[model samples]
Target: MVAESGNGVHLLYPVDLLNDEANRDLIKGVLGTVAERFDDDDTKLDQSVFNAARITKLYGVVANKGDHIPLAPWRLSRIINAPERNAVVTIEQLRALVPVAPAKLPAAKRRGNYPAFDLLDFLTRLGIGYRQDMHEGRERFKLDHCPFNADHGCGEAAIFQKAGGELGFKCQHASCVDYRWQDVRELLDGPRESRAGRATANGNRPGEQNAATGTAGALRVTYRRVSDVQAQPIRWLWQGRIARGKVSMIAGNPGLGKSQLTASMAAIVSTGGLWPVDRTRCTQGNVIFLSAEDDAADTIRPRLEAVGADLNRVFVLDAVVESYTADGAEVRRAFNLKNDLAKLETLLIEVGDAALIVIDPVTAYLGDCDSHKNAEIRALIAPLSELAARHGVAVVCVSHLNKAGGSDALMRVQGSLAFVAASRAAFLVAKDPAGDGTRRLFVPMKNNIGNDQTGLAFAIESAEVPSAAGHIETSRIKWGAESVTVTADEAMTSQGDPEERSALKDAKQFLIELLKNGALSSKVIRADANGAAHSWRTIERARVALNIQVNRAGFGKGGIWTWRLPHTPPNTAIESIERHTNCAAAYEKSGGLCEEKPKRNEPDWEEF
Candidate 1:
């Protein structure tokens, strides 16, 4: 289909494509090849409209560019060409028309004496007319008048910054194709004399201060001793569960409120609300959310509003703009962690006081990296952790638990182990095994900087948020109590099933008592477990939890596996179990889960 856009003609290419990164590349490639093939002075194809988020001029719209005069009149944009049957265009058909496009402009090389150049500041000083833009990672400034030739005012002339921070100038006009940034720099700022002459006049040695490294020359590395560093305490966001300037994660099975937990945290940070566990008031700041799973309008915003979030302080990173043309054209695409960490850092810096950031189901932004590879996952997440630390913001990533039931709680986080390893703290959200199914537990999976916290319980409850049209219903977290003794490892195997929890508890107790005195043959342990109504599976789970040592006795046909407790005395082992059981019994009898709020009289969560 084709239409008149008032200012320019619009050509719509309907291709059989899924809205994804790969198809975006394909569309851009086809556009580039077609533009190169159809180059002419009469009309030019707008290459900036290749992004998936590019907005097009709709048919039958009144596009007004100037006063409605004969010189530059307003025009009605209507479909000039159409087919009777609006059939979808296939990828194969698009590929058949694609040809090898011209190579991109080569990146400008940097000299050892590249100065710390600020393009915008320099342009402002020169009183030059320009429009700022970006494409990929490069910053572009389209000059209103070409520096080489003032007569060429076409939008093809630009000054841009490359990824390595070197400045360059380009003008597509045939009269100025050979000129470079050095030429433009010399024209703007006088021609450079000998380096030695300039340095001697400035009272500095050759390469005395490198702009990028801030050293005499290109310094590769710097080392420091541990004694020279001062120790610092961990800055807690949610006391023990989360830390400021750190990356933490929450993992859980489906329908366990993992995303809701992150939304709750964002609300607290935005509104300076009190934390549920300690009742400490939070420091209010802006929050950034990059959620791929939930809809921002219906799912995310409604939940935030229901929980009394400061909507003005909550910002969602909608898309990454790759490029912008002089005529207000943009190429926008989805944000990818593997490719856009620098962009994310730029955003954090722009926000100034970002207290928290939430990335729901980080797998959606992994890009092409293999999520299961430890090295790749570490390489991707380490920089994010560092960015969090550098910006002093709490980054909370939501993840789904693997389907590996009865496994270690730490190992149950989906994808690479490095996810849990790289994070300073990680938590698991699961349904409470000792309470009614309405209650969910947020328990620690691993914590490196703080003492273990007693798992807290909360329930998802409906809330009515006032809106322009009456009100809308959404879910918010209603925290139950903080002194729950349930661990994530315990909650995982049972998953709100009281019978399974009891059986596992019984199996653990049976093994602890039976193996406390001495070693026992595996066969005998299994038979005893069966006779005691505990499945062998449950007994094996208990063995793993206790970190039992397995020894081999005899050889050949008489060989057997023996299970024994690891070196701890029988009394200490029994004491641990008894204490744990007593705590659970005490918590249950207090009716903590059924209460709207934890009793203020009870010990605080940090006291645990």
Candidate 2:
């Protein structure tokens, strides 16, 4: 087949000659003639080649030769004339032949032991072109030859030069920096130098690839082991403990000298004297007394003076109740002592460090004592505790005993158990039932930080009394039944008789009446009831007999003592009436009186 070109004819062999070396060389000679002729007109032959039929013909040629022939013309031509040529070439008939050399491999892939520049010269001999420019927008200029001149026209032979042991060419123009290599092997055989991974078209990883990159392993936590020598130091509730910061509850019934003891503590702490504990002393500082129950001018000042406290060092905030609110309803608001504590902070800052802050009769500052609400109680003490901790001051809160008392456990405290639970240490005061005018301040009803079995027992002597004038004395005593030995027989014998029980009940009723008006010291009330058939000891015995409990006031001058009813009087009365009233009519009315009363009555309602 033949195709026509602008100046000559393109002869296409009906048989694919590219598979035959003789035929390929013949075809190249014909094309080279065309190229030489076109060179005069400053033109070149346009070569368009396809491999579709060439591959099929190459297979048949290989089979006829009994082995595949190397495609390169130089290698194939040598093999064609060998002694085995008869066995290979005689099987296939020559359909057609053209005058052309075999097509060369791509220059970049060509390989030899020669240097790079020499190999590049060989590529120019193969009619390949190479050009370099400064990459102006997008154009390249030729330095050696003008394409418009026929004498120096572009062609494989005109541009390429064969250096020693090399077969490519370089432009000789002084300004031309362009050069073409004869072999492509140098480009392909060089190191790839690719990055670890391929970049996407938009230069980011795919979402899944990003997720893989973002994956992380689990984290580990480390804990250090500490030796005994490196352990944190423990704090005592008394020594530096009290001074460091602690909320101490000084509780007594009515007047077991709680206020007076608080006053003395204020005086001592203000003077930097040792507190009357187990002989252990605490460093003292300024004292602020928030006494809601005492008169500053008439009561606290005189009492503090009597105790020999420097009035200047002792600051008595006797008007906390008034300052917080006027009406008792506002008393709840007073329970939150934070605002008042702010003033306290200013005072501390002004006066230097304060060692102790006292809030007497804590019930007055508490929101609601009867509710037993934990949150209300917590709100009441949290700030106070915080203030103490913040300022490194000992906060002493005075509380009263509950009506239903027993051992100085959480339940015995006046308000919610949370009150005692929240405190660092709680001291309870109850009068000595034996009429010694001495009170027993139970160690701790509750002590979160220290021992609960250690407490102070002291006698309260009034300086105002003629016998005790100018002298305030207190004696320390200790008595508890934790390890006393009593035989079973002795215990049975000591039990009270029925008459004694009845007398105890009467005494209990009297004590209940006294407590209704607020706590009264057992000493003062005992003197008032001196003539009554029941002695203080007998009353106390009856209390124990009937399971009635009382808290003792600790020792100090003017230390007031008080008591609480074992049970509600109305309930007790109703119970007693139900048990005693056994007449048929009274028995029938028992259900109504003891339970609920009926609205309607019958004709026999009054009969007994």
Candidate 3:
């Protein structure tokens, strides 16, 4: 019979069948053949309805999906067509039409030496909620939550106990694809602490008596002598900047290419590329990047691709699978550094060749810890430091710079000083003092494991990377020349120096007089600034200070930037004024184009 299934149609085949194994196999093969033959883009055959005992929707029933949308209105499901005489599909015809041989059955479950333990009793003892039901002649318990990773919100996992006394676990989430019955079995029934091997609340085993001693009830502390300890040399990821088997931090203000800088480092490690400072080849390995601020697809992946990173070697730890709900639902949440480091360690072991772990803006993963408290910060970082050292991976924590002007570079890190103290090396990303605003300096703030190294300058520039959705625009780091002399502190100091302030003041006056006749192209202004023996950096600073208006004149390849003094009338024909120390004399020299003071009711005009 052909029936309308509300939004679509369903074809039903009636067959004389039994609930035996042979009949089930025959029906399964027939359904599979029919599904494969008729499946298409717009319609799909329901493969899950092949079981002989499954229920079907009754004809003439109201098939209201209750979506309450115009496209999915309620409809009556009824038979559309029926044959004059019902003819059953023959099992021999189905066997003949089978397109390919049936797939091989799974190997028999290996019970081995595992004892028959009550699964329900075990789950209840562990305080795990579950709903029990029968599935395919076996007892199946739908877990309230996924035991492997609670973060998965979908309810598609269950624990089934077969009639043959075999246990199985299955979760439909892609994240839990690697999970097996053995993993869940171990999770629920940890190490078998039988009636004999279990330890008591005190430091003694059952039936054991403690002798009378002064150290009774005191915890046991073990110590090793220096002679028994083996020593090792420090390994460097980037010599004198980032060290392997240790914690490192990179701090900077926003828009300083901190993320791009980390991506560059990841790219180097992923592809075994050369370091920017030292031209040494790094060990090719996998990288785990946990970014809380940027999206992996649009922001992180494009940057990695732009830098020619081995995309396969780069992994993003987006979130931790926390737990599962009772109906086989997964509960996922953010990866907290405090509680999830153990989980991260487990992942690193699985990745095997992981050489780097980057936690961008480490502050985002602090997880309720007081950022400014030394004790809490150290407690959180100590294990992370040990994990990195144990795994021989360099963990770089990206952080933001606090607005503490003229302070030491180490002090400018946004959190407690413990972050820098715990780290073997700390670097600062600051704007380069010698270049225009585009250049940035990656200078050392503190280094305890390597010699003093000169800072490297880099610029963030836009690049096009091919993605599934064609090309996209994203920024990547372009490493420039090394800053052999200037450091982070020196750069920060010069930015606020009185002498530099005076030079910026001079540049502003020069810009006003140069553009007094109206807008001038940026190229002309820069060329004049260079001719005046002023760095383009200072001139750009002056422009920002004066709120200069910059506009592009054309589109695409022919576009050019034109700079105008803010509020300057377009095409105004005004006389130019000579550079002078006396502000009043310059105002008179320009026919009042440069104003020393505003007229009684007029708005203020900037001086030359």
Candidate 4:
């Protein structure tokens, strides 16, 4: 197919034609000019007189005598990889078949008697100074400490090679005006004259007639061996919870304090606080939090203060407007994980030395993209993950749970499974079944990095912090407990069949012991119940089964509620009443010694 104008498109030639020397040599000069002519216009492609094989192949037959093969993009690459031998495949020969057809390709630098064992032997033998530097956003081997600049400190002398056996050099240094291409040729003792630009290393000059492809701007790729890659240690923001240079996910149901947990994490990161599991402290650094739901001043800032976070190091990404209308109204609003990632990356650079980033409810940022599609979701997070790895920062994306009451907690996390799959570590926050009302737990749903995974317990409590505008109520998390063995299943595991797990049995035993003393307030009971390793739900179940009586006294906000066993009377209370009655009876028997009976509402209650 001919590429349309304004698309900046260019076609790639087949590997077989590209590797052929005769075709490569003949097409070198005319590729750029000819490709530009036939790229968009069909005046060239109108003329086509093909052989019987070409005609039959269109219908997907074998074309031995009469068979056609299906034409497709995927199959094209495979076809080029395994081409039939003994075929006329030059530009002029192809022009005879389709005189007006468009074309495309590649070309590479020449090396004499090219052998697999020693490709860069010439450069190595001469001890030419070169270094790997970034060009067009990729690493390329280029001349370093220019041969001409070595004595004069000219930084811009560059050496390059072309496909037609030519060595070129140009001093980019503004002051060094005497340097030319011949100077390098005279030094390296290479070809006197040739074309410029590195070709596709495999030896092709752009294209050869109809040896064409639909892939645009085709350039060869270079690779480095595994030994050449730099090694780095896995860093953890919270040991076994969040890791740096990797995407980590924390998911939970709404109102389960997932955001609060994230804020607490940010607090720790900003202040260099100790982690719960190992007490390992992280170096203090700025935290970039992108929150779409909470108010920065009211909800987020207060929550941070409650957690004792350093306010200076915490930054809330308020709004990211992609474009605006004539009236200056925002068009694309806020940080979109799919589209505004580049903007977020820019923000990362602005806040240099950033250690952590929190994207609360990451699904909110995937504007207009289908979250359920695995490919789309993966594509969205992959770049952000790469950004994290590039900056050596821990990226935590918060997500909500699906209401699908499934047995697997991780699967219940809403949207594509890739959200969890792509994360290096995945965590879940939920009200702990075995914890007090103030208790919440961080469960390791998935740990792809290592096996030191363990569940952490924390408590969410309201703290009254004094502010300029009076005391403010804020929520904070406290993590000072031992690691628990409960898996993520604790969040989704149903007690519907209390018989399945001993959690109910444990709750019953704990409650029986706790209530054995007498009636206790439900609040205290619930807290102690959780502290005793009994889920509050199970405790409520046991309370129902045991037929415990719940009583209320007084009224309004000042009213108090209490729990008491139906069969057990207050024995201590009964004994005290009996002793008072006996004393009153003895006083009456003593006549004058008997105290005057006071009104029923009298404050004193003694019998003389």
Off by over 4 Å in 3: 1-228, 325-329, 494-608
Ranking by TM-score: 1, 3, 4, 2
Q: Candidates' TM-scores?
A: 0.50, 0.38, 0.48, 0.47
- Compared with the true structure, what per-residue lDDT tens digits does model 4 show for residues 1-608? 22322212223243234534344334433443454356452343211111122231232222232112121112211121323444444566544443343432223434332212222554575465666454322223466555533423333555544322233455655423434445443334322222222345444433322234543333345588999999977887776567889999998877878888888888889999887777889778899999989989778989988888999998888877767899998876666787678888898898887999998888878876656555556667778889999998999889988754334676677776668877888888877776664677788889888553578888777888777898889888777468877778755564124453477677766776665545555655776876787777667767775687787634674444566655555662233234334444555588736454322222221210
Q: Rate the local accuracy (lDDT) of all candidates.
A: 0.73, 0.48, 0.74, 0.62
Q: Write the per-residue lDDT of candidate 2 for residues 1-608, one digit (tens) a residue.
A: 33332223344434434455555434444444455455443454632232323332221122222112222111121111213222222213332332234344334322232223333344354333545442211123232342111123243222222111222333443212122331122222221122112334434432223344563322223356665347534244255224347787766667567777777766667676655644556565788777777777657776776676777888765443443344534342243353465666676677776777787776665432222444445655667778778777778778876544223234446655556666787766655443354644444555666655455555555553112344433311233433222322122222224465476668766664544433334554576567676678667755555454454444464233445444434343333233323222343566534333322212221221
**Residue 504, candidate 1: how far off, in angstroms?**
4.9
Lowest summed lDDT across 10 adjacent residues in model 1 is found at 596-605
Query: Per-residue lDDT tens digits of candidate 1, residues 455-530?
Result: 7889999888777777888898988756587777777776635576687788888987776555566766787787
Clashes of 1: 0
The Cα error of candidate 1 at residue 214, in Å, is: 21
Model 4 vs. true fold: TM = 0.47
User: In model 1, where do residues sit more than 4 Å from their true spots?
Assistant: 1-222, 324-329, 496-608
The Cα error of candidate 3 at residue 461, in Å, is 1.7
Worst 10 residues of 3 by lDDT: 573-582
